[model samples]
Target: EAGVVQSPRYKIIEKKQPVAFWCNPISGHNTLYWYRQNLGQGPELLIRYENEEAVDDSQLPKDRFSAERLKGVDSTLKIQPAELGDSAVYLCASSQLGAGGYNEQFFGPGTRLTVL
Candidate 1:
């Protein structure tokens, strides 16, 4: 268990049909994030990387949503056709200095996707 590494923690599709999510962080923590917790609402910041250079996705919403981090270590987020409000809880946090840096982000246990 590294720190920020998401997977099939939970996922159930149906709506538009198209889902993909993956992440890996916590090695050298060069700053990485990909939040979207809508249940109780809290984690927002849809994207933010520095190692592979995503800079700051600025809320991220390019049409149907999409993300990547080729050489940034590991990162992948996509939602081609999934709708139904996109469900929620897809967190993937990692920090070592970002958005006022100081390292305090360590959250995973997410991916509870359920769109029907």
Candidate 2:
């Protein structure tokens, strides 16, 4: 009954460097999501996975960003050649499918990345 977990709670890197974030969702959860939040802004969905299948990822930048959910359990998100604009808090969330299809996401402490 653990909550979502993320590593390297903070990261600082120069522009053009590659950075990656990891996430471990709660057990028995059928849905996982990755979001990015800029300062003073609400989180924006970057990607969503139903089990191992990526159901939504239109917001993720394909050129320098990639994500994967291995075996429908854990997930990773990467941003290559990072830019200053990419500085934000990356959040991972998970939710269980319950009665009436209620799926309330529980978020993890985000990885705050600062690009210089």
Candidate 3:
């Protein structure tokens, strides 16, 4: 009955350092997503997972970013050698896939990453 859960609500690091974020979706939810939002911009989908499969990840930066949803319940997002441009809020969301692919997402309090 819980919504999405994220750890380390805020993070600060020097440029070129690595950073990671964690997320736990709501119980019984089959879809999970990770998004990044720059200041004054809407969230951009970084990756989306249907259970254990990553269904969409075109926006994710493969060279320095990676993500995984192990066992289809929890997920992690990592950015290696973080850049100053990577400073933003990382949001995790989940929803139950319903009939005809209809679902309403629930979001967690995003992790604010600051690259110094």
- Would you estimate the TM-scores of all the predictions? 0.32, 0.94, 0.95
Candidate 1 lDDT over residue span 1-116, tens digit each: 45777898999989998899898888888778898989877878888888888888878888999998888878889998999998998988887866625658887787888899
Name the Cα RMSD for model 1: 11.6
Clashing pairs in 2: none
Which of the two, 2 or 3, has more lDDT? Answer: 3
- Give one digit per residue, the lDDT tens place, for model 3 in 4-108: 999889999999999999999999998999999999999999999999989889999999999999999999999999999999999999998642147788999
TM-score of 1: 0.32
TM-score of 2: 0.94
Off by over 4 Å in 1: 1-29, 44-67, 73-76, 85-94, 97-102, 105-116
- Alpha-carbon runs more than 4 Å astray in model 2: 97-101
lDDT over C-alpha atoms for residue 58 of model 1: 78
Task: Give the distance in Å from residue 40's predicted Cα in candidate 2 to where it truly belongs.
Answer: 0.4
List the lowest-lDDT window of 10 residues for candidate 2: 95-104
What are the lDDT scores of the predictions, listed in order?
0.85, 0.92, 0.93
Per-prediction tally of clashes: 1, 0, 0
- Candidate 1 at residue 80, lDDT? 85
lDDT of 2 at 40: 100
